[model samples]
Target: MSERATPVKPTEEQEREQSRETERPSDGGADAAGPGPNADGATATEPVTTGAEAVVRALENAGVEYAFGVQGGAIMPVYDALFDSEIYHVTMAHEQGAAHAADAYGVVAGDPGVCLATSGPGATNLVTGIADADMDSDPVLALTGQVPTAFVGNDAFQETDTTGVTTPITKDNTFSSDPDRVGSDVSEAFALAREGRPGPTLVDLPKDVTNAVTDREPDEPRVPDTYHVQEEADPEIVEAAARRIEEAKKPAMLLGGGVIKGNASDVCREFAIEHEIPVITTMPGIGSFSEDHELSLEMAGMHGTGYANMAITHCDTLIAIGTRFDDRLTGGIETFAPDAEVIHVDIDPAEISKNIHADYPLVGDAATVVEQLREAVETSPKAKKWRAQCQQWKSDYSMAYEVPEDEPVQPQFVVEALDEATSDRAVVTTGVGQHQMWACQYWTFTEPRTWVSSHGLGTMGYGLPAAIGARLAADDDQEVVCIDGDGSFLMTIQELSVAVREDLDITVAVLNNEYIGMVRQWQDAFFEGRHSASDYHWMPEFDKLAEAFGAKGFRIDDYDEVADTIEAALAYDGPSVIDVHIDPQANVYPMVPSGGDNGQFALTEDQL
Candidate 1:
């Protein structure tokens, strides 16, 4: 697995120097060269670049550095064109890995991540990752190849309706039939993915269209101002929200993924600090505010911190910011914030009343709305009492688990050790399940864009690929960690080849509990402990598997070795996997059963 060098386009000064050299005459003549006509009798102002070249150039203009995918027959034209472009093409073992990696790249890079795949199975394989991006509102551009235009309706080999398959999962989908339009279509796809309420966008390229020769030059990349239009809350609505906050005795704020997307952490923090309001977050909104902040209540609902759930349940006025109050966070609509008057602020108007009713709806960007509210809001007299109560709850209902000195390692302990090792600089990603919840619960994310997970889709095998993407998008010095479970890790474990081949600096900590831990836990709590197919009688030796894939691997069972193993994995120059044998029977505590209200959490063994 050798690394490839893909240099970025030279700076403007370098371009000018190259142009001067090219235009200079070898004979030192007065006239060097003039525009000439081609065989088509058109003035040759610029060399004819193919549609495939146009697509690659457009992506470069848009500041894209990498494109992830597995190549196939229909998509070979784009790969051929990529040889001359600055963008690095990452070849993955599976198309699904490419899609997940691209999705995670979009989340960490603050730009639309690009992924390419072929028609038929390749396009179908991208559906899960596209759905994940749509559910989480991450911006990703999915490009797929199609059968030649003439044979598209004839059901040519390897042909499928790429646009139709991706329509529902993407923000927008389009098919290109004309070679000349590929550049502009690709540009629009990126814009749609990144505009208000960011999501995945799909562009299907016909095989002939990419291979066709075209004289049309690529369109200039759309300016950010053309699409990233920010909406500000109306003054009246802002004032009304402030008035509601002032009137309430006990007020709390619910932060969601929108805050991170809108980059409103600083303003959100200021608003909370000035108003002395307690803050809680949704699963996708974990890092919007620092968990260590004095006013922060961490996560709320389902597997959220007990105090945060209690705070939301008891607050008189609930200010929901950049969040959609999904079922996981709300539990039951009728019981969620039953007594509180809700004031919702979001960039998307549809989300305002989609879930929980908003007594005062401010349809605008979260950062802009928070800034306005900060200017108009005043400290309430009851804030002091509410703050004291929240602090007490945090102290009394802290997330706790007892680790027997002689028993197998607990999953939570592994997360704690990893957190201590990373020191908040690592971008943490997780697959859906117990490992996901434990990572969210135990890791202290002090900054935005540091925590990535498939929240809405809850896709298994998302951790490793997403971590790979995050590492590629992040600064060279930044560390990336994937907290995975045995069940989820195996789903797309083949992605280890990409990580190892690229020499990415990533640490994968596998909580090797030999069962589908979440399902088994649910069975124990709700179904009389009937394991069914949840148990894994045979498991792969992950350390050996890692070594076979050309990466470092470690297997640890003793609790005392967890910290040292994690530190060594992080210190390794290339990708490494630390497989810790965790207690299979260990269950994630402080859970709110399905349809249960925030206040009705199952806390202990007695409750189970």
Candidate 2:
């Protein structure tokens, strides 16, 4: 079994039958290809199986070690086939959890993650995760079971047009009608998910198709011949961009998620260091650059570091790699990097000038294009004074929060304490909210794939499920930590049961403020302090809740309890939750309003 596969034991009867078959069977069949006489029959020259078995074989051929999903009627055929296969299936608490888990697995493992679900609500439940992957460019392959082809358009029980619903979100989608072609459809979907600009793909497997018998085997996963990605940018354009960088008095390098996805972190890091340029990353690009380095400006955006924003405001040359320039990162495009000439590098041609206009667009693989620039550059930029200025800005606006003796526990304190306790390589996952920002700001990321979270879609219940995926993908030495908020945790907390069942070692720290913290903060800043529906006063005690789910639970109410609770929770063998009650009034600092200039950020509401 693969290391990632956790074998689910078979029943006594099933084991006995398997032993009997092993003891009696000795007729090995010769390798050949032909239509099967029957589902179970095999010839000396040909081996025959059902379509469902072929699906499992295709996954095995593709080296799939793990899969995440739920059991259902339409998908029962595939699940039954999986029972005999070596692939390990993580039965998630919900289909949505399954989708997010697969997504995070892809993010961490650098391979396309697989998920499965049945028609109707099960298929619908996966929509959010699919959309999340679509927006963030995470590679995920979703397999959804549909009603039998005969019943597909008849509105039969549990019937759903899954392909129709997911077409807009997936990079490609297929509805399998022929048993002979079903396995290939799945392979194609899996291939398309990780090709070029990575994104989600889906294959709708109808019950009849999966149930039908077939001898045809799926080919190795491959995209159509027509599909192509430009691995190397135009050599002339790379030369021009290098010239701009060499001539720049104030130059900065911006790394995005693509730097990590395309496996270009090392080259990008080397290029930046060789040229002595300050590096800034967007939220999704957190781990692409080492924040511990002197040239690092951390993340740049609405809640980015003050110095990072300042560098963008005044830099004469901005070499942005792998980012789509989301509005959150490029606040008020008219004001963002106004003085700089932009050199944008992205694998997708559509993203080059889609948002912020790229003065020098270099469209190709991130690593390849960066290597091109590295070879083409003749002289490094002279930005000694500019680098010093960024250092000074870092000192001027430090990421410090006051945890007074008389005040409630600060969320920042909890974040830092957790970071201090875990190794630097520990994988961090989060849901959308104040806690997410705190994790992004306080936790120092120095490695790619170390940071996993819902970025583009901002899904609330992403943390715990993501932890499950990251834990499976991560090495045994690396710890999985989830920094979630009360609201976000509550959304997907049910997955805690799955973690406990699997005996996964992960610690979830819920920055419990008894409110939809980010929404309440926004209400405070933008809505005249009206609480409205943002308050979450009736929240459950997450520490006690974890215990109810048969896992260790700890709570922190005072500064004295913070360290001990986190230690105790991390020490526990299985899933653990530290419900650290944070100060309700605390808010994310260095804030920028929608479309505001990145340079003019407020440290507090009064400043706003």
Against the reference, the lDDT scores of all candidates come to 0.84, 0.88
Per-candidate TM vs. native?
0.92, 0.93
What would the per-residue lDDT of candidate 2 be over residues 45-161, giving only the tens digit for each residue? 243267787777778677676788988999889887776554567889999999999999999989889999999989999999999999999999998888988897888999878
Off by over 4 Å in 1: 1-48, 223-230, 379-381, 605-608
For candidate 1, which ten residues in a row score worst on lDDT?
Answer: 24-33
Give candidate 2's error at residue 528 in angstroms: 1.3
What ranges in model 2 sit over 4 Å off?
1-48
- Per-residue lDDT tens digits for candidate 1, residues 1-608, read 12222112234646423433452222222112222332455432344477787677678667776789988889888876665444557778899999999999988888898999999999999999999999999999998988889998788899998888788899888898888989778887887788788899988989899999887776765534445545888899789888889888889999999998888888998888777889999988888888988999999989999899999999999999999888989998899999899999998888988989998999998888888888888755367888899999999898878999889999999999889887676799999899999999999988889999999988999999998889878765567899999899999999998888767778999998989999999988888989999997588999999999998999889987887888788888788999889988888878988888888887864575
Each candidate: RMSD to true structure? Answer: 6.5, 5.7
Q: What is the lDDT, from 0 to 100, of the residue 177 in candidate 1? A: 84
Looking at model 1, the pairs that clash are none
